[model samples]
Target chain A: MSEMLAHLSLGFGVALTLKNVALCFVGCLVGTLIGVLPGVGPVATIAMLLPITFGLDPVGALIMLAGIYYGAQYGGSTTAILVNIPGEATAVVTTLDGHQMAKQGRAGVALGTAAIGSFVAGCAATLIIAALGAPLTRLALLFGPAEYFSLMVMGLCFAVVLARGSILKAFCMIMLGLLLSTVGTDLETGQERMTFGFPPLSDGIDFAVLAMGVFGFAEVLRNLENPEARDVVKSKIGRLLPDWNDLKQSAAPCLRGTLIGGTLGILPGNGAVLGPFASYTLEKKIAKDPSRFGKGAIEGVAGPESANNAGAQTAFIPLLTLGIPPNAVMALMVGAMTIHGIIPGPQVMTKNPDLFWGMIASMWIGNLMLLIINLPLVGVWVKLLQVPYRLMFPAILIFCSIGIYSVNNQPVDVAFTALFGLFGYLLIKLGFEPAPMLLGFVLGKLMEEKLRQALIISRGSFMTFIERPISAGLLLVAVAILVIALLPSMSKKRDEVFTE
Target chain B: MSLNKIEAAQGWRVRSTQDLAAGLFMIALAGLALFLSRDLSTGTLRQIGPGMLPKAFAVICAGLGALLAFNSLRYNGEKLSGWSWRGVIFVLGAAVVFGLTIRGFEIGPLKVPQLGMLVSGPLVVIISGLAATDVKIKELLIFAAAMTIGCALLFKYALGLPIPLAPWLLGI
Candidate 1:
């Protein structure tokens, strides 16, 4: 315990320096500024801003980038609340109840709850990382390719269960996502399986391009089609602070969400993506009045927001302790670390204790800074809702264009994004949810790689999955969860008939 | 919003037109993928070929899509909606125009010099602005100019990204 304290105090010492604080503040400020924009998520925000940090030292650059990540997360939630558009898959859960709250003149409460929930979750998660991160790294390393494959399968099953639509349709979307991931060149064989002779596609589709087209551009088209639904929140913006009762209701869920998010975030291969979805599902399942969930439930906003921040924070453990990036944002951090000539591994802690602890300690300060930064700014964000979609959407378009183009100086990516936007609009028209597909797109490549590796390790023996205890356990859980989820929905549908 | 139109069928109408459309779309997509990957070898499990997953996933996608289509006939579900041509055309056209203008494109004999952000930025704001039914040229043009300038200063100057403000006029 004393050793941990000593390390933390050292971290604070480095992080508290005037120049570092200024960098952290700037990172958080700019991260929020750009993240609050519609369609731009944390990853995109970080990618776009990466070049700016090139001039700074490694530690200061990372601190600012970490601050930017947290800022973007908070800002992403703000956008979700006001506009009903989630910048990324994690924020999708936030939009469900957050936007509904906005439409009901409770936007301020939702925003407040999100900010508060995030702060609490962030603090708790940071502490967890500091305490458990080292030990957990050993467990994470124990995951063989088979274990990873099984874990991902379980995650997909959970996704299937949580999907509001038919299970078959969800499967279809997941499969489609997997198919899309196969479009690029094969990692091992150097074969372009699905690129159709396009030189640009040989590297596979960029995640940012797909996200911008689907979430940002397609949203504009959907909103343009329905002006009434577009400008929904004309009612009064309530108090900026959450009322006592609001806090009272959100307190427990905030903690529960943190726990759920933190656990999932620790898993490798971007497990953090599932945090909000899992928390939202748990909240709805346990809610006294489940029907109020998609409408404007405070718990929905509180739980998922907490879950998202916690998951995101814990996800940093793998990156800081080991070289593995848990998600795309962490992957960018890896890129940043590489450019700075710091290889991220266990050596990071032993070799550069100050840098490692400073980054983590800076995350603590960064979270506090976000709460301070976002509390007053929530009002400004709400006022943005009053701007007509006419002006707002054009701005979204320009920003999205710039954000996407800024990633790679390639114009073709923008054109491809436009095409995906059309594709997304079509998917909406057909009553298909895009969230599952996006999730599938993310997990697709990882799943295939793991499956291939597992098979190779087992030398084509399918039973290797069952032979391994961890893999077997995960697959068992996956099946059990699937069956359990199916039973409730079936019974519920039958009960509806009886009630009628 | 598109009209929830159920096309007239012979004896058995598609109860869930939305599902039917989705099923059809998925199947077509899968079939296209299969065709594209026809020549690729699906190697054995020991050393799986690149084609293994795609071909396998495409086949399953087709199967699931067929199931969705069949379910559409049995279960009552949502009808497919209509599309917004105006939003589709102008919004996407603006994005394409931004892409073409931001960096000059040369295709075969057709060559266009780079217009940079000064030209591309306002073009995007203005072209996309036209998607609105009540777009005002006066206000939109003003907004466009202001937005373009703000973006130029912010992206090129403040952030110091290598994006050119005006390449032909003033080389960066």
Candidate 2:
């Protein structure tokens, strides 16, 4: 515990530096702006802003990016409360009771509860990362290539379970992503796998380009298709603070949500997305009047908001400790870290303790900054949302184009983005979820590398994966998840869980 | 027979167009991948080559695609939604124009002049703005100008990105 404190104090010393604090503040501000804008998510925002981080130190860049992430989560809830539109997938559940509360002239209370819940949850998750991160890193260091491969398999299965709509479609998307990940020249051999004679294709496609194209450009296309559902901002935002009764009711739910969110966020394949949905289900199940969930229950606002923030914070664990990104946003972080020559993994903590601890420390400071920014500035965000989609989308397009072009100063990347945008749109039309595809893309390269290494070590014996205790346990879990998903009754229940 | 009765009679055999299209696309892509990587060395299992994973992925994709296609016939599913061609064309067109303008493109037989303009940002904004249902030219023009300046200041000056600010003719 003393050693932990010593490390934390060192982290505080680094994070509290004037430049780092300023960067954190700027990241939170920009994150909130991006989050407030309907259809603009942090994945795209981070990808767009990645170029700017090139000039800064790694710690500052990551601090700002992390700030943007949680800030966006907070900003997304505001839009959900004031207007019915959810700015991101995590905010979807917020729209249910959050919008209803706005209609009842309790928008301020809803917003306050969300901010407070998020702040508390963010702090709890940060501490959890600090305490458990060292131990997790130790555990991750023991993992061989076979264990890593098995863990990724388990992660992909969890992704399928959590995906919206058809499980078969999700599997296809994951397969497609893995295919796309193989587009460049083969790493082991100089042989070109699928580059089709293009010179630029020798290097694999940029993650930033792919993310911006799919999440940024395609999202605009989807939003533009349905133009009728414009922003309907509630005119009256009552008191910003919740009453004593409201606080009393929210306290337990907030704690429970943080626990649920933090645990799930440690899983692979963007399990953070599942946090809010799970919390909402839990809240509704435990509620005496379950029907009040969608009709303006304070518990609904408090629980899911806490869960979303906690999950957002804890999702960094796998990225920081294991050097594997659990989701697209973390994939962007890996891109950022690679640019700065700081490889993520167990070695990050020992090799660069200051960078590691500084980032963890900055998260807590960022959460505090969010509380201050979100409460007094609620009106500003609401006013920002009143901007029409027609005007907003063009700016997004220009930013995306510029961001992609600036990455390599080559127009070819931008063209690739445009092609991916169309592909993403078509996938949407065909009812395939793009999120799993992204996870698959990020993991595919690493999984392939690990599998080959393990195979080489084991001398062609496939039993190597099952022979290792950890790898066997993980593969067993993956098989269990698949078996459960394939069962007819369980599959029906799974569909109901997602659709509901 | 009425349309409703025909639909009822088809029942579980009725396939969703969306699923069918998606399934076929996946299968085609897998086939293309397999064909492309067929010549690459697949080496032994102990020392697997780059092509091994691609081939493995191709097989899995094909199997999943077939399964999805089969499942479509067994369950009722959503119909494919109408495509917004105007939005699709303009938005994608804007990105293409931005790419071409940023670094001039040239083909031997059919030639479009290389105008390596830095005004790609504003050009993209204006073109994509037309994708909206209601396009106010005056508002769009103002937005385009403001965005161009904002992007120039942010990317070029502040961030020191080497994006050009004007056309070659301007001689800035």
Candidate 3:
């Protein structure tokens, strides 16, 4: 305990530096701004900033990037509460009660609840990481290739349950994403798998390009196509803080969300993405008036926002300990760390105590910065709803194109992005959720790599999966989930829960 | 309201589109799987080969694609009409033009040479914006020029990314 305290103190010393603090501020501020912008997600923003992070000190770079990740989650809730546009997938739950609260002239209360709740969750998650980081890292290292693959399979299976739409369509999207991720050169044998001889195809598709093009640019096109959908809300930016009654309702949800987020955040997947969904579901299940959920329940905004932030912070644990990125953003974080010549793992804490502890300390500092930045800017964000879609779409398109091109100085990526954008928009039009596809794409790449390695090691023996207990358990769980998701009775139960 | 034929047609169209997409994806996955498995030497253990997992994934893709296709045929559902062709044409056409033009396109001797991030980034957006039914050409040109200049300054000068400025204009 004394040693941990000393390390934390050292961390604080490094984090409190003028340069580090300024970068954190910049990251958080930018995170909030972009998070407010509809259809522009944190992943794309992180990928775009990857090149820039190459120049910073490893610790400082990671600290700033980490701030941006959670800061965006905090920022996403503001738009969700104010205008009903969820800037990120995790923010979807925020829109349920958040938009309703806005209509009820309680936007201030909703926004305030989210801000405070997120801060609480962030603080708790930071503490949890400081206390449990070593142990969790140890457990994460036990995961082998088959285990990783099964974990990814489980994550993709969970997506089917998460998609608030047709299960069939969601599964299809997931499969499509996996297929798309398989594009480019096959890493193992150095053969082109899906690249039809286009030189750009040689590198395969960058998720950044796909995300920016499909979600960012396609959304702009979508909004422009339907002018009536653009200018839906223009409510007065009510009070800047939550009232006593609002706080009373939200406090419990924040606590619940934080606990749930902290536990799940330790998982070596996109545990952060699960936080909001699980929190919202838990809030509804525990609510006295469940019917009030979709219609501006303060608990909805508070719980999910908190969970989102907590999850975002906790995701760093795997990276900090085992060198595993739980998601694409974290993958970029790893790339950023590599650029700075700092290999992330268990040794990071021992070799660079200042950097590890400093990062953790900065996360806490960044959470406070979020409140300072987001609350006052809530009014400005509300004003953004009034911007003409015509102006906004063009700007969004331009930003996406520029961001994509900046990655590798490649025009082909931009063109590829355009292709995906069209494809994505088409999928949306057909009542398909794109979330599953994106998740599948990310998991598919890793799945291919791990599965190939496992097979190579085991001389193509399928029993290798069963030989590993942890991997076996994961696969069993995945199979069970697939079976459960397909059960007819579960669909009825799902409908009942969703409708309720 | 009872479902009309038009509504039903729309739904069928949506499902058919999805089916086609899924099918194409599956075919691609199968092709890749077949290729990946070609060189794999499966020994007596019959323990899944390196190509086995990929083959399984591909088969899953094919299976899912078939399911999607089957479902679409079984359910003659309707969906809302999607994006107008004009918008699609503008976005897609602009992209094609940008790709093709990167090799050679000149304006006032300031040639927009091949595959430069500096030139293509702004050009694609501006050209696409001008082509958009909702966008005004004059406004787009201004926006495009400003965006280009801003990008040039930001990426090229400030960030020191190796983005090539217009060939004739900057003599790079």
Which one wins on DockQ? 2
Cα RMSD to the true fold for all candidates: 5.5, 2.6, 4.9
**What is candidate 3's CA lDDT for residue A179?**
69
Give the fraction of reference interface contacts each candidate recovers: 0.75, 0.84, 0.30
- lDDT (tens digit, per residue) of candidate 2 on A112-166: 9999999999999989999988999999999999999999898888888778778
What is the lDDT of every predicted structure here? 0.82, 0.86, 0.70
Ranking by DockQ: 2, 1, 3
lDDT of 3 by residue, A1-500 (tens): 77667767887899999999988988888777666766556765565455544446788888888778766666667767776777767787888888898888878778878888889998898888888776756675677777766766776676676565667777777777776777676665566654657787777677677766666656656655765454235566578688778788889999999988777776665667677888999999988889989988888888888888888888888778866666656766765676577877777877887888999999999998888887887767767656555555555565565556656656667678778878877776766767667667766777777776677678878798988888888778777876886787887776554443
Higher TM-score: candidate 1 or 2? Answer: 2
Model 3 ranges off by over 4 Å: A44-57, A181-188, A231-233, A243-245, A265-274, A281-297, A318-358, A429-431, A495-500, B1-54, B75-80, B92-122, B131-133
Q: Would you list the clashing residue pairs of candidate 2?
A: none
Task: Give the better candidate number (2 or 3) by DockQ.
Answer: 2
| Better structure of 1 and 3 per lDDT | 1
Compared with the real two-chain complex, what DockQ does model 3 have? 0.32
Q: Write the residue-wise lDDT of candidate 1 on B1-172 in tens digits.
A: 1123443233356788999999999999999999999888899999999999999999999999999998787667888888789999999999999998898999999898999999999999999999999888899999999999888887778767678778899996
Question: Which regions of candidate 1 are displaced past 4 Å?
Answer: A1-27, A30-114, A228-362, A488-500, B1-12
Off by over 4 Å in 2: B1-14, B109-118, B167-172
